[model samples]
Target: MTTTLTRPGALAASGHPLVRPQAARHLTDEQIAELGVELDAIRDDILAKRGATDAAYIRRVIKVQRGLEFAGRGALLFGRNKAAWIAGTTMLSFAKILENMEIGHNVLHGQWDWMRDPDIHSTTWEWDFVTPARSWQHTHNDLHHRWTNVVGKDRDVGYNLLRMDADQPWKPFNLGNPLYNAMLAPVFEWGIALYDLELPEYNEGLKSKADLKRDLKAVGIKAVKQFTKDYAATPAVAMLTGSGKQALYGTLVANAVRNVWAHAVIFCGHFPDGTDTFTEENVEGETRGDWYVRQMIGSANISGSKLMHLMTGNLSHQVEHHCFPDLPSNRYAEVAVRVREICLRYGLPYTTGPLPKQVASTWAKVFKLALPGKGHFRKGKPASA
Candidate 1:
């Protein structure tokens, strides 16, 4: 096989937003090869584990789900109470969110093999955990990776209402109230569906709009069927079904809690008040490496407990995950050391740590931006790590 590949030429652009803040920091061809080898090995481990996903891992996943549902239910039922129990829950739901953001959504887009099998390399799998490869893959892989923060090209710039760019001002969302915006984000897991799924499906380059229309129509049918089944069975639905009363009853309780935990876990990562949320344009001129570095810095990591970071896969270490996404998250703390060295070399902030620290940092930004004359673009100035 012969291929003449060319880098996007990000480093060469002296005007790149990242060039000044970051010096000429790059992996040597050889160094990159070594890292590739390291990642390949980790993929093997992941695969082996998957092969043995046996009763134990399955049980653990189930147990994790059970706990997640419980916490989620508590949050839904006792809204404020669930928030109070934030410290009580494990990292399972949190991991699920990042997993959904990066893994589930994109893997759904069609990169499951690469995620499970480390031997292939046609598609980029390293950052697939955060950037996604499906609908998101287009933004991160084609747009963000190539344009790296460019205004129009990098689809990551919108806030559904607020422009992340200082140059533009357009209210994109109807955030009814301040508290609603703050508190409701967790339950709205559909934020992903809205941004990645809906936006593209309705607008953008819908290659064959007619084809998409047909597909959507089919999907609508499936949704209706599922809804009909649920309505016939659930107490909440307008059309309640009278099926295996015991099983139906149990499912309702289990499902309600499961979804809440799943959403809460994910909501905690980026939805907190303080994390940086900017337009793609502000950082457009930045290098991919710098944008890569910033995503880590701008986003706050919960740095949940070791078991949490471990089982949840260091979603708390969002910075590390973005810095060297391919590296096994177990090595996130270790790789974070290297990333910190790079940040120091480049004078960039290395944002990360445990959940309490993450929560504090997140809300600090929220409160800061909430204050008059404070919002930076829309995010307020960067916070200390």
Candidate 2:
């Protein structure tokens, strides 16, 4: 959406066309159109090839995740034993992570809709998170993806909490930036649930009170179901076997681990060095080519093994995911090769690094932006494919 350029130096600091003239000078209008064409071809190729193999991949993930959850919960019934507690917690953590990252997130993105399986379809899959899938799709898929890194437009820039970008006016509350992020990591799902309610929109009169109430009701109902399953029901079953306290603690720890992992993967993909933030001015009169270019520069990737990629829901290929959000997550590695080639040909930055480096860079940004100043994060350097 178009927003008026109101923040002082918003354009200049954006490092985009209006912000920094030399930043993106390599791409002319004709070149951007050509880049879009190449990217479109990649997306189309994947779409055409989506078949039994892709379907099998998601099904296998679902089966494994469900099995782990069952084993974990069964183990938790005897969680009074030290070994059982450890095993249960570990299995539960993996199960929750796999469900949220690979199954829930991708399914809700409509990546598997082509399979025509209603049970796994985006409209039906309620993820293992606090936020309702529909609310997340509205805020994440519809808004955040559409706006990417644009200041004021993408609420995810700071999740309406921390001051992630210098363009965001610092407030006394921002003094807690580092602390806030640390705390947020353990309860990221709750934070996202509240964010998905769009409270700011309600305050600004953009959403009616009735609508806010409706959203709150949805969240409340979902929260009850989640709490009942994890806390009440599981612990009650354990109580019959005399391990209620242990089961409760196990589930709590498992959820925290999943939350922290999700937080780190998401931050690395978005806040790491080299990813660009834009001003609304950059998007005005934008074309398909310009949009494609924005996704390339606005996102970053994590370089690692197949297992790391799988754990991150293939979001380690963040650049590719943003370029083609609807494409199957299993195919991101192949897509990354072509995407990197296109970036090289276009002289665009393909920002990426190992997990540790990206996590450190993103955390450094959080600490730096906590204070009030015209501080700038380091620009991203081109990464090797």
Best by TM-score: 2
Candidate 1 local accuracy as lDDT?
Answer: 0.41
The estimated TM-scores of all candidates read: 0.55, 0.93
Report the lDDT of model 1 for residue 94: 44
Stretches of model 2 off by over 4 angstroms after superposition: 1-22, 378-385
Tell me how far candidate 2 lies from the true structure as C-alpha RMSD in angstroms: 5.5
Deviating ranges (above 4 Å) for candidate 1? 1-186, 198-208, 211-288, 310-313, 326-331, 360-374, 377-385
| 325 Cα displacement, candidate 1 (Å) | 3.7
What is the C-alpha lDDT profile of model 2 across 113-189, one tens digit per residue?
A: 88889888888899999999988998988888888888878999999998888778888899999999999999999
Count clashing pairs, candidate 1. 26
